[model samples]
Target: MEDPYEILGVKRDASTEEIRSAYRKLAKLHHPDLNPGKKEAEDRFKAVSAAYDLLSDPEKRGRFDRGEIDASGQERPPERQFYRDFGEGPGGQKYRAGAHFDQEDLSSIFEQAFRQRGGPGAGGHRSFNMRGADAHYGLSVSFLDAASGAKRRLTLPDGQMLDVNIPAGLQSGQVLRLAGKGMPGYGDGEAGDALIEITVEPHAFFERDGNNVRLILPVTLKEAVLGAKVEVPTVKGPVHLTIPPNSTSGTKLRLKGRGIRGADQYVELKVALPTEEEIELETFLKNWEPKHPFDPRKHMRGR
Candidate 1:
């Protein structure tokens, strides 16, 4: 495995915040959801995550720096051992390979011969059960999908498919766990889980505030001046909204229970004028005079 520092593109003496920032930047770039169907990017994302995992842990980082553990976080074998079990023994009895022997005895002999090999299976140890490592993945969903709940099939890096169920009102950065979807276990142990981190994509016109939805609704000048009922969009669907007469830009209105989880939807009205020149309207405005003069900027001046 490549060095964690090199993978994250950080200096050996980088601070925690610096490492975190680097990881975040790389993660954002190589996130699988952002680079769909790109195997290289997905692999890079996994490597970055693993690197950050090792460096973020103080104990692991210290061990790695001290040469006690490798870049993969596995312990390094000692340089020398007291006894050499592979070659000639003290009495000149040699252990030769490819020689037929009892299954139990061969297992014991191999374990003893390779005692320096680290982890559960080595070191002359008896058979043991070990749970598999959990697999991590990133998934991206649309804002509406997250708000309304939906089912999506995710294609893993290994080409395996998993159906993910997104719950209603699911927020960004939420995690969903799939049991037994990770690597295989050892010696009858249970398989690990697959942890999928969800990222919610932003909408062009809609914004979320907690459970409530916010939208900037553009209205014509005539519609704003004379009350009109317009069809507005909500998480559930499009609904008619009543616009009050003489409403100006920045006017706010609310639609009850139109947002995620029964939350309200707030619409801020923006009065938009016609793009082309309106000869009649311009002439009317020039000749028209209000009975009550109003200063729109009065509140901003001294109040």
Candidate 2:
């Protein structure tokens, strides 16, 4: 894989928001739905997703920046190390055996140390192989992304960038499992998995109600009273909706299939009065009396 920052088209010091913004733009452009049967687009999409997976994470990004890991999130062979980082030792001590000792030599040394302490199993032989512990993590997605489906990159604790598939209509606080994304297994043992919890962020202009998207649309008082064909916003786009004559605020209008698949968008009308700048309107209203005697608030208290 290419350098993660290069793949995401971001600087090494880019913020999390910048990384996410780049990922969303690239992923949307090359989404399989937009380009069918195109291998190159699919490949680039995957690469971009993988890159975002690494650079979006602070820990993995730091590791990559410090040269402890590569773009693929694999740990580089240490320049120098001792066995204590991986396991226990006598007197909880540290060693500087370095590259001078081979794997077999280290195993022999550990075996001798264990034998000196009378190892656990029968005949004083300790169990050498054990599976690593599973890890847990959290991932956040946008409201639209959660509703429309998306692919995201998660950074594992060990500096791995994992590609996560988010299903459409995914709710908040959901759990996703990634096999072998957790801690590395011990000798001859299988690596553990990672469990990721999903968090969905709130939208500024859209509210989700089951399969529907609710939006409040404001219109001029003239448009509401005289009735007009006005453009209303939906998740997909804006559409012209006819307002019936004498329609008041709190009126509901539905646009079918404009939300999630098989879902609708519900628009609520809010009639806005003219501001002080429109003095003519205030004068006309002061001199003109209602031709039709109707009490809209007759049902309210103190009417």
Candidate number with greatest lDDT: 1
Worst 10 residues of 2 by lDDT: 79-88
Tens-place lDDT per residue, model 2, 1-303, is 589888878887888878877876777676555677787877777677667667766777898899888887766654443344544446855554453567987776666555544455335547545455455455779988888889998643233578999988887767787887766776666886776768789988899998788998888888888999988776666898888887789999888888876699888899887665888887897899887878877889575
Backbone clash count for every predicted candidate, in the order shown? 0, 0
Q: Residue 188's C-alpha lDDT in candidate 2?
A: 65
Candidate 1 off by > 4 Å: 11-46, 49-69, 73-75, 78-125
Could you estimate the TM-score for every candidate?
0.74, 0.55
lDDT digits (tens) for residues 243-271 of candidate 1: 99999999999999999999999999999
Model 1 residue 1 lDDT score: 78
lDDT of 2 at 160: 52
